[model samples]
Target: MEPGKLLENSELGLRILAGENGLNRKIRNEDVNRPGLALAGFYRNFAHDRLQVFGQGEFAYLLDCGGEVEGRIKDEFFSYEYPALVFTHGNQPPSCFIKKSNETDTPLLQTTLSTHDFILNFNRIITRALAPQTSIHGVLIEVFGLGVLLLGPSGIGKSETALELIERGHRLVADDMVHIRHMGKGELIGESDPMIEHHMELRGIGIVNIKDLFGVGAIRKKVQVDLVVFLEDWKEDKEYDRLGIDEQTMEILDVSIPSITLPLRPGRNIPILVETASMNHRSRRMGFHAARSLSERIHSRISQQITEDAERENPPKKERKKASPKPLMGPV
Candidate 1:
């Protein structure tokens, strides 16, 4: 799913938040989970669905499933309760009502938005919602059993490179923002934010659609990462590896992922490099360490030459006295 499309799907929610036409209903559950916001009640009512709100001295909320609950209003009694309520639930009609409740001496303000409008605004709020005060942006790609994450300074062609990989018959696990969940045994699963899957923002181009461009097979919703690829600007003076001896690593959510630093220079085919890196990584995992093998071969040759040199310097002493001593002992 493209970010734009995700935004489009959530347009109703956005509109509802922006005071669009959606259902206005009260919270029916005694506990609503907005720990930071401190909103009360778990039950949210959708106006489109068959919902009946009964309020005389207290309030009772009824749902289509015959699930009815009686509870006292709490939290933001002045603000949220002041204006009826907006229901952002999907596939439900929008409805609202306001009348004199005994608890509040002031008359309640009953207002409602259309169900269609609530859905439009709901999506907007979800995509733009903050990440629990602890979140960062980056792209993660999984290839050849190697979870190589592409990281760099913003606009450094992270998404652009990923787009190329997808075109070259690779899968895209996540883009822009990845949600890394730690499943037990030191394993991490990388998933794209629901609202921004399969979307990349190109500098010259506004937003290129990945699935549409490369077909449905090019995009993936989630994947387990095996390596990280860090792209850097090419520097003339900086030294780079001519031999594949050094390995690198990167950390995400406290999990370490093998990293490779590749320079972005003109005429350099990065997509090919990335693919080769992934294949090399896979090769190493199958008990074939190229660097170690090379080192061992060099050491064995050096040891053999030292042995030959030591033999040349000190030849083996001849056993001249042994045969004569054995004959003399037999005669005695």
Candidate 2:
């Protein structure tokens, strides 16, 4: 990430106070440092690679220090090649510090946000900016709150199914090309190409903007991919899973995402199937596997039937009748 890119983002509320020459400097670290210890002349463990931040305490400390002491601290701080310096809570750096930053070609930035809020936002922005990314040909949509990626060869009804889903109130994330970023911990975020976002191509019709045709509610900027569905032409001899007892997955960017293959055939509603798959995937995630539950119930019933048959074959012995006492009582 570059300081200029951070400046461009309105959410961060950052502005260049000095050292515009260092706008192109790259920020390799996804973290920021307070540099409190370094300001107090302790630089043993100072992290020079991160963006140095000056919060309320650090700014006040600089203001209270004598001219000579402040100059000494500024010289020592700029000696290291830190990427940039940020002042939070609208605090401004001292003149000597700003001058040193310009002399060292280090970026000096200021934001009105509080220290905690600034750090939180910066971390999120930097993490996404530095995450591993890749692009694939597919349609991404949010069905029942789960992000589903529709995969298949071109002209296999991927766009048409997405259009039907959109008409059914499901939001479309990307069409034709999906740009995916791998946020660590088995998470992948996907978005559409900027030029073609919210637009879909039909076999008969040309490009059409989904948002313009169906309204903004039918579109989404991005979504996390939770399930991958591959659609292929139905084969006469191919066998498909009738009871979803075996789970399947698709690997994207080294992350394993739950996936299923649907054979396309006449009279099969692909959109409805996709919706059901999305819901089923969500249920499985919540620990309720419908297929496994049904299988277990069937096994239990069979075991019970076997026990009943065995008991009937070898019945318990009947107690012998005591006939002599009963006969004497009857005769009297």
Candidate 3:
């Protein structure tokens, strides 16, 4: 696999499904029997009070006030046909068992659902289930202050070029799977996922440890990306750019990264080309655009042609036309 590839995890998911470690809890028949229980999950009933809660799933929230959800759930017992419990604010009591109001000072699940304390606890549980371990596998390249994601068909020598770049002392930000995070101002910060950090897979060879081979100086935890280079097979008929004047860009996460297409050929040293392209890209940002320079040169030659043609004909200058204003009524 190309470096930085994410693998599937079924064991942990299956374990959660197996009801291991109290991950799965069955709702009471009364809870499942309720009308909205199909839509939400379970409902909580309070004793000696007008308070009632309708919540669902492993993550549930209490309704702080009646009619919070207009026409959603009614307050009467007939409106609540599901099972629920009351418990103390912070205590972990039996959620499934029915409770008498005076029996325990602990608030029922319904009473505490809207409290900040409940939301925090519920969030913690939800995040735990969704989190997954990720790994890093390849060098992440950024150019021209624009984030470029260089993705191509596999075995196109992406890592090898990156290795060459590192040998030349350019910093290696991430290898393989880059975890790209979009900041508030639209900046894309890419980092190698921690679990698979500093590792690379080279074709015709096994996994190589980048940190061990190139040392700590070679690897960077994160960096901003600016360009994307997509390397592919060279076609003779394909019109490769003769001049570096056109600006092409690839966008990811709503941020545009300047892009270049590099053709892979036997005699071509791709690393050198990519690096030079990156340097040239940087130069363009400094206002020394090569394509614009060429275009201006062409324009200058065209202007000279017009001057030569006019001189050959030696045409006389025409008189300037004057604007004719409307005649005043008295003058007529």
Candidate 4:
């Protein structure tokens, strides 16, 4: 990310201190550093390329150091090319910090948020900006509040299925080219190409704007991919997962998401099935897996039946028939 983009997007309450010339400087990586060792004259493995963060601890340490000592620290620290330095909690840096920033032509950024809060928020932006990403030809849509990516060979009716889903009140995130990125924490965020956002290409109908026809409610700028549905031509001999007990997953950008293969054929409602799959995916995430629940219930019933059958097969015998006869004789 560029310094200007960070300034525009960061929620850290950031304000520029000096180094207007460095606003165009690019952040080399998502890694952030506290400069604890760099402050103590340990330049080895200083990670000077990463963004430097100054909190209360570093600020207090700077205050205790003599002016010359602080200057040496800064010289050694800023000698390498860094993205920028951000001070948390609106802490004004010692004059030495500013002087060195101007001398090195490095961007100096400060934030009003506390050290912990700033780190929490900045980490998220960093993760997004530097996350691994890839582009795939598919349609991303929201089904039952779950994001589903439809992938298959060209002309497999992916766009048509997505259009059917949009008609059913589901929102479309992207069509044709989906830019998917792993936004840390195992999340894959998907968005459409800026060139074709909210647009789909039908076989003969040509390109149409989904938002134009369906309005903004049926459009989404981005969505997390929860499931992947690959539509394939119906193969009469290929077996399908009729029971849903066998779950499948596909990996994209090194992140795994649930997946299913739907065989396209005549007289089949692909959109409804996709919606059902999405609802089922949500249920599994909510700990209400239908397949597992059904299996357990069936197992319990079979166990109960076996126990009852055993009791019927071995009925209890009558005890002491002779004793009953004696009692009858005495009564007579």
Candidate 5:
């Protein structure tokens, strides 16, 4: 992110205080730093790569050190080529500090938001802006609170299935094209393209605005992708997963997403299957796996039946041998 971008974003409430010439400086660090120590003549291990933040404590410390001490501190602090300096809670820097910033060509910014709120919003924005992204040709929908991405050939009913899912009260995120981002720690977020957001292209109907037709409740800005569904034409020679015991996954931006392949037939209910798959995915996340549970029960029953059959085939020898030994000990 550049300081100019931060200034352009009105939601962040950041405005230029001084050093407008340094707006193009790149901000490499996602985190901001408090320069209280650097302001107190301690520069060792100073984080000069991040945005320097002057919160209440730092401002108060500067006020305490009047005259020469403050001026020297400001000079030493701005000596490094840090990205920018931000004053939170509407705290304006002193005229000397602004002059120093201008002399050094370091951007100086100010925000009216409290220190905590500004950091929260700033981190959220920076994380998103710097995240790795990719695009996929698929339909994204939110079913049962799980984000589902539909993939397959162009004419494989992906759009139609998404339409049916929308009518069933699920929310449509994207259609035809999806922009995905890798949010660190094994998570993928999916959203629609800016030009085609909340719009779907049906075969005969052309383009339709889902939100305009179904109200705002039927669409979402973005969602975390939890499942991927592939729609393929039915083939007599192909075998699909029926038991669902062997799970499948599709990798998007190096993150593994649970996936399933469904064969399209004349009478198949694709919408319902998608819904069930979404619910099952959620259930599995919560540690309840239906197929695995059933498989375990079947195996246990088969093992018990085998034990009964073995017992019947060869019964334990009765106590007749013990009685013969007792008789021999007593009288032949």
Candidate 6:
């Protein structure tokens, strides 16, 4: 976003302090750095690309710095290629820092929010604005509180399966081009592209508005992608996991999501399979793994049977009859 728009945005409530000429600066990344160490003459490994944040701690540290120290800090801090400096909790920046900001053509921003709150809000804003994103040809649906992405080749009935899912009361997030963004820290958010949000394309029926056909409750603006289901045309030669003992994963935007593959064939109920997969994934996350538990129980029973058969085959020999010699010796 342009540096000027940061203040004009109502949700952030940032005010421009100085460097009006730098309003056109573009913030290309989502990272926000607090310069607590930078104010203390420590510049090792300093993150110069992020927006610099000066909270109460940093401000206090700056107040304690000697004149030469403060000058050096300001000179070196503004000398880098940072986007801007933000002071939290309505705290006014020192006069010398403001002068340096103006001299270096760096934008100075102030917010009325507390340091913690402003950091939270500013980071959220920047993350959404600059998070890594890509769009894919698939359908996103929320089933049983889980987001399931259906991926397949063209004309493989992804939209048809999604339509059935919608009919089954599950909400559709996006169809036929789901826009996804990785919000860092293992979060992958999916949404419909603006131009095609709430719309779907069926092979024979043409395009349709899901929201219009299925009401507002059948659609969502966005959803976190929890599970990915890849549907493929059934191949007789390819082996598919029947017991689900070996779970699969697919990586998107550096985030590894729990994934499962479904073989599509004639008369196969894709919607039901997707629903069951969603529920099973939720169960796994809740710490109940059905496949592993069943395997363990079956193995235990088989081992017990094997031991019983071995005992029966050998007919464990009985101990020989003992004499009463011990009693007689004691008496003697």
**Residue-by-residue lDDT tens digits, candidate 6, 111-142:** 88887887777778878878889988899999
Flag regions of model 1 displaced more than 4 Å: 1-135, 241-246, 321-332
**Scored by CA lDDT, what does every candidate get?**
0.55, 0.92, 0.53, 0.88, 0.91, 0.88
RMSD of 5: 3.0
Ranking by TM-score: 5, 2, 6, 4, 1, 3
Cα shift from native, residue 194, model 6 (Å): 2.5
Top candidate when judged by lDDT against the true structure: 2
Which regions of candidate 3 deviate over 4 angstroms? 1-138, 142-148, 315-332
Candidate 6 clash pair list: none
- Candidate 2 lDDT by residue in tens digits, 36-125: 899899989789999998899999999899988887887787789878899999988888878888898889999999999999999999
Clashes of each: 36, 0, 25, 0, 0, 0
- For candidate 4, give the lDDT: 0.88
Q: What would the TM-score be for candidate 5 when compared with the true structure?
A: 0.93
lDDT of 5 by residue, 1-332 (tens): 89999988777799998999999999888989998888888899999999988899988887788898977986687789978999999998888789988998889999999999889989988888888999999999999999999999999999999999999999999999999988799888899999999899999889999999999999999999999999999999998889999999998888889999999999999999999999999999999999999999999999999999999999888875554344535655
Candidate 1: tens digits of C-alpha lDDT, residues 1-332: 11122224433332222222222332232211211112234344422122122222122132321212112233233223322233333222212222222233222222233444443443334323422222346777766545667878897788888878877778877777777765535566677777777777788887777888888887777676788788889989998876667676676667777778899988988989999988988888787878878988999999999999999999999887654344535554
Model 5: how far residue 149 lies from native, Å: 0.6
Find the 10 residues in a row with the least total lDDT in model 4: 323-332
Winner on lDDT between 1 and 6 is: 6
Higher-ranked by lDDT: 1 or 2: 2
- Winner of 2 and 3 under TM-score: 2
Q: What TM-score, over all chains together, does every model reach?
A: 0.56, 0.93, 0.53, 0.78, 0.93, 0.80
